[model samples]
Target: MSIQILNLNPCYDHWVIISKPPKTPNVLRGDYVVKLVDGKGLNIARVFNTLGFKDYICINILGGDVGKIIHAKCKEDGINTLEFWIEDESRINTAVVYEYEKRMLMVNEPGPVMQRKEVENFLEFFSSVLKENGTLVVSGSAPRGFGIKDMARIARFAKEKSCRLMIDISGEWLKELLNFEPEMVKVNADELRIALDLQQMNLGELLHIKDSYNIKVLCVTYGKDGSVTLLDNRAIRVKPRVIQSDYSVGSGDSFFAGYLYYEALNKSIQERLIFATACGTANTLKYGAAIFDLQDLESQLSNVDIMEEEL
Candidate 1:
């Protein structure tokens, strides 16, 4: 079977723009634009689709009319979607743009809370689809009231099915789920700092996560500084390739997709990290969450510098 990735959480959105920041007793004065879809997992799915990979998305879709619109957009993109319908409408995250000051502010909704039965149904659906010898990616945040135990259950199920699981999450959810022993975990520097409960840990200190968990890989993305991957007591640091960036949103997801694509092809870990960095840098050249072409990625892969060190 082809590598199968399952996205448990997804969102539909309306990205709006405002001329200025709202003050006390704020009133609307600017344009209110609505975008059809937005979510971390969906973004990853988009990138994968562009990369010509066969993948599936599993999401609990809510709301009435808007939910249909979201599903329509996904179908238009040729993305395979498996949805669980619910009572409330999907969320709309607003991005307020202050054109004069050249600043942008985003306000996100908490989304609808999932009932106990809804959660159980989602788990059962996921367990049935999961297959051994395939890879599963569980990304993004869970709805409120969903705890780490839920994550642990999914991770454990994937493990028993002999599927490689990769997670990208932050805060208490990430802290609690680390005990489940995923195949790989990715987080930004700030999240890493908070999870370890330290202001800063040197390279040596950062490598300790591998010793503590049976995790095969731990990747830390450092924005313009590029990223570092720890595997089997060796750390490889990849420097950012010079590229003009229009937006940084979804760059990490693109990187993860790139790494996993190469990994599923059985590439070495070093090669995987190099391709991952190239994918991330290539994303900087495009607007929104657009994916980089494989031909372009292959051309740029040689330019990426990977420095390896042993801890």
Candidate 2:
């Protein structure tokens, strides 16, 4: 079976912006440009497609005009989407800003609530797809009424089927699921602080979680400070590659995608982390959640510095 990504929650969007920061009233004197597309899972699927990986996106689709637009966009990207349609319209998230300020203010809609049937259907679909040993990535936030335990449930199912699960999430949701012991957990610095309840813990204390869980890999992304990966009884730190920032959105997802791609090939954890960071840096060179080009990724990989630190 091909690697399957079960994106339990996803979105559609219309992005509008100004090239420079607005001085007063935070209003730009230009046309409100609108671009519509699938959100998180779609972005990850697109990157996987660009990297020539076998993948599928499982999402819940609500029926409406916006849903039609989302479906159309997913088709354009060649993403094989298995959607569970419902009564409500899909949500629309917006990001508004001036490019020069290097800051974006976003307006997000609380997604539609899933009925019991919707959730059950998604679980059935996800389980059927994982009959064989393969990689399963469950990322992003759950909708209303769904808690971190939901993620743990999926992880549990994957575990029962002998599928490797990689999770990218934060807060209590992540904390609860850690008990399930995913194969890999990716957490950014801010999330790490909350997960370990370490407002004052040093790097050593922060790195100790690896010993406490059945997790094979623990990745802590430090934004511009680079990223640290703990694996095979060692912590490997890689400096972030410098690049002009077009937009930081989706960089983490891209990094995870890149990491998992090379990982599927059985590369060393150090090599995987380097490629992952390189992919994230490459993502900043483009606007929106654009796919990272392979050549650019390869070039950035050369500049990535990886060092093993004593725990």
Task: Find the candidate with the highest TM-score and give its number.
Answer: 2
- Please write out the lDDT profile of model 1 over residues 187-216, one tens digit for every residue: 887887887686555676666776687778
- Global lDDT of model 2: 0.73
Model 2: how far residue 72 lies from native, Å: 1.6
Question: Could you tell me which residue pairs clash in candidate 2?
Answer: none
TM-score for each of the candidates:
0.85, 0.89
Error of 1 at 228 (Å): 0.5
| Sequence-dependent TM-score of model 2 | 0.89
